[model samples]
Target: MSAHSPSELELERRAYRARQSRRSVLVAIASSIAFALVVWVTVINTSGWAGVQQAFFDPAIAWDALPRVWEGFLLNLQVLGLSVVTVAIVALLIALLRTLQGPVFLPLRALAAAYTDIFRGLPFIIVLYLVGFGLPTLADERIPVIYLGTIAVTLTYSAYVSEVIRAGIESVHPSQWLAARALGLGYGQTLRRIVLPQAFRRITPPLMNDFVAMQKDVGLISILGATDAVLAARIESAQTYNFTPYIVAGILFILLAIPTIRLTDWYTARLRRREQTGALL
Candidate 1:
């Protein structure tokens, strides 16, 4: 019997073409709809656009709140950057602890699990309030609200990130561990040199997704009076009695979020390609 059949090859080619056509049509429709919506919004919000234009071009209004907005943006970036870095480090530690197996590891694992469960199960707003407002009152010390908010976010996000790291580590094949052991690597050495590296690559997509989520979660800090981008816009709107500032803030958020989203998609696609290549190999 021949390995290739003409009719089967033709069917496979036709199926591939059909799938490509469907994807192309979906993309076209989505693009068209998005474009149309943007046009419609621009047309309907002409007055708001005019306000924003005037505010930007008019030196008085532009200069008045611009500095405050920039300051708030810087503060937001600081909070976001600090929280993410702290969470990543702490999560890694917790994940490591959780993965260890022994009687002595039980208490440590229980503590890590409790931390994750408590934070992941609670509402972010409640956590923010507790950390920002409630803690200071209890401790009788005046902690900066911004610092409190940052800590709260860090704690909450670290729990979720720990789970990601734990899952990533577990996904590394047992054969890889055995191979590392055969190479005379100890448990810690095997994990650090082989298992962790592979797991890190495997979890990059999920980690990036968490980053995107954290970026938006930064907005929640505003509820704690952290004066982040959202709070800045709200304050500006309240003082000026105009909605343009809020609209501007929303646009800025979309600007920030869209790029992160694109990067996430790119990373996910790259990971999938790597997986496919590995499978083929």
Candidate 2:
């Protein structure tokens, strides 16, 4: 075979990769369709198929529920937005505190550790209930449900996020910290400019996964009557005596979450590609 120019080789490699990618995608889709057909056949052959359709798949009910449920979902979007900021700030601070190097910080480290352990070990529902309903008993006036739900989400996710962030920080070689210190950077400066950015990049996938979970868990806040989509669905179901609205609400959430999940996967894949390119060069 004749030798190829660099540009020709690059073009050939790209074309080969594109063909392989298309083949893989076609195979995946074919497998999914086959699997889905099998499941559909099995389901329709079951004795309860008609009942299931009536209860869960009524097209008219789904259509009717869409508008109301969507309105409630807007509230969920707001909660998710606020909670992301709240969780990220609190979790990063907790992670940093846990990573402190001094004996004087022992107490703060212990406190942060305890906080994470307690919150992580608690059932999410319990935390939501305690924050949403139980706290108001001690106060003279009712706390706004939105704030309470946001607090509950923040407390729960921060514990998890802080631990993920801590892992990312610990994954970085200690030599980097030593080098930063040797360069006369203070602890705060080293962390701010060097450590955290790398740590956060490492934790991006897990953090995004948590945010997806948070997107759904905020549905639990509907239990406090905050009138989010799930709550709206529940109310509509109560009035109509059908469960299809809940299914509609669930479908909406899945649709909303798919984009985030895809984005996270893409970013993680892009990072891997970049790392491989660097390694190869």
Candidate 3:
């Protein structure tokens, strides 16, 4: 190969370095602006520097309501786990029905669509109330409001998850199904062995996103009289006649949300890399 001219090579190298330098400067400026804005808002809204100092050193509120807050946190975790598991199972069934194509499937698809649309359109509080109060009257028996809240979360979230799963399944290539059928695999065998595994991998990021969304929705259970973290905080605040319990609860929610956020980001990045490598191959 012929060697490049010195001037041309130097110009290309300088251009590459300039692009990297510009990106670095842009990132730094953005970070600085964001940090300054956050500080300005915090100072302005929180009674200046003195209030910020007091907030950091405030142990009085935390010490008093820690027990109640802990209990509420545990309850929140329980509801989240139960609701997420229930929703996942329901979502998978809905996804299967959605993928089928026939006159038989039309009514099933319509029902799934209605389920998704109604719950997604309704406010979480309304669903909570309907389940909590409406069910008891209809059944003529007192259902525990907490269990009702779990059902509400599961029903609403499963609708959303079903759509996610259906999209994931549809993204798989038709050739995979053709190949499986050529090998004498039945519909169920092809779906189980060849389709769902790939779909699950593709759907992992959205599933993680749904999970994080569900974590926040756990607070909605509190509206139905479930003693979730938010409700616990409110009760503690009422008893102590202090705003600190609410602040404590907010911090706890942030703490809980952070791990889910991190996990989602990590899984998304990993999947993206795998997808890119697969594409290149």
Question: Which regions of candidate 3 deviate over 4 angstroms?
Answer: 1-57, 278-281
Task: Report the lDDT tens digits of candidate 1 across residue range 1-281.
Answer: 86975698899999999999999999999999999899878764577866656643444544466666667766777888788879889999999999998897899999999999999999888898788888899889888866787798888999999999999999998999999999999999999999999999888878888887887777778887777777887798679866556555555666777988898799889878866885773
Residue-level lDDT of model 3, residues 32-99, one tens digit each, is 99999997787755656666545533578777777888788788888887897899899999889888
Best by TM-score: 2
Q: Between prediction 1 and prediction 3, which has the larger lDDT? A: 3
TM-score of 3: 0.82
Using all chains and alpha carbons, the TM-scores for the candidates as numbered come to 0.78, 0.87, 0.82
Deviation from truth (RMSD, Å), model 3: 4.4
Model 1: how far residue 124 lies from native, Å: 0.7
The per-model lDDT (C-alpha) reads 0.82, 0.91, 0.84
The full ranking of all candidates by TM-score, starting with the best, is: 2, 3, 1
Give model 2's clash tally: 0
Residue 248 of model 2 has an lDDT of 92
Give the CA lDDT, 0 to 100, for residue 267 in model 1.
83
